[model samples]
Target: MIHKLLTREQIEKGYIRFLEKNPLALMKVNNRSQQIEIILGKKLSNIQYIETANILVEYAETIGIDSFEYLLLYAVESVEERQKIILLRDELTKHDYSVNKYTGNA
Candidate 1:
């Protein structure tokens, strides 16, 4: 199970509403080697929270995710758990290699 920043109703509705309104928020997940390096010259920080609801959405785009995983990105959130997710994503990419495999990545 994953920590939640919103109720069931909120997750259902809010996730859709967010995607509809801020399509760009859905695209900020992987700037690691490209734009961030080009614009910022260096990674100032992890790709935590870039735009509206970005961090939470990034959390959703992970492999084998349930509803509330990404919202767990918090002050009390464990870095190890997040590392596991990143590893899972990387492993999946090794097989598929499609950005659109995850909706949040697209």
Candidate 2:
């Protein structure tokens, strides 16, 4: 067995790269208000959004399901925010595992 530990920068960069891939299916732009609304399609919250692309979940673990949503709720766009997002994701993941170690949705 082999395991590769990833650095914080590597993880952060991976998240940034995922966002660059345009995983979102739809986003409505309100030109009048200069706002963008995510079309979760059928999924409810940002957590549900991870279902669309399970592999991408970690990137949003610290924050929501994507960069745009993270920016929206957190109202920030910077490395500091990314760090916070990553921290949040790890905490949530840990909590979830402790509660439901078996039969996890993943």
Candidate 3:
């Protein structure tokens, strides 16, 4: 089930993390955020990285998922804060794969 979860910006951070790991996604999540800021002509907090993962987990039960462990796994790999922009390609691609497969469209 789909829950009203993860804002595009947060998902973008996940995409960013995925990119850093894969280095081939070419999906510029940071750029996307920047462009969004430019389009709105306003600045937004950079808390999207930390916030999104938490938000996804908070609402996880509603979505019939255990936790945001899949996403959290990368972000909290070593008990140290990591840059969210680093994994835009790989992890996000996996998430996309999961989505596609879940929908039986893969």
User: RMSD per prediction, one decimal?
Assistant: 14.4, 12.2, 13.4
Top-TM-score structure, candidate number: 3
lDDT of each: 0.47, 0.42, 0.49
Tens-digit lDDT track of model 3 for 1-106: 1122334654565535744664422334345556667777655445334334444455455566555434544434443332342244346767889999999989
Candidate 3 C-alpha error for residue 90, in Å? 27
Off by over 4 Å in 3: 1-17, 24-26, 44-67, 78-106
Cα lDDT of model 2 by residue, 2-23, tens digit: 0122344454444445545544
**Candidate 3: 10-residue stretch with minimal lDDT:** 1-10
TM agreement with the true structure for every prediction: 0.26, 0.29, 0.31
Candidate 1 lDDT over residue span 1-106, tens digit each: 1222234544445444554554564455344434665776765333322432454555567555633444434322467865665566556656454656555554
Q: Would you list the rank order by lDDT, best first? A: 3, 1, 2
RMSD of 3: 13.4
| Candidate 2 lowest-lDDT run of ten | 28-37
User: Which candidate ranks first by lDDT, i.e. highest?
Assistant: 3
Q: Report the C-alpha displacement of residue 60, candidate 3, in angstroms.
A: 12
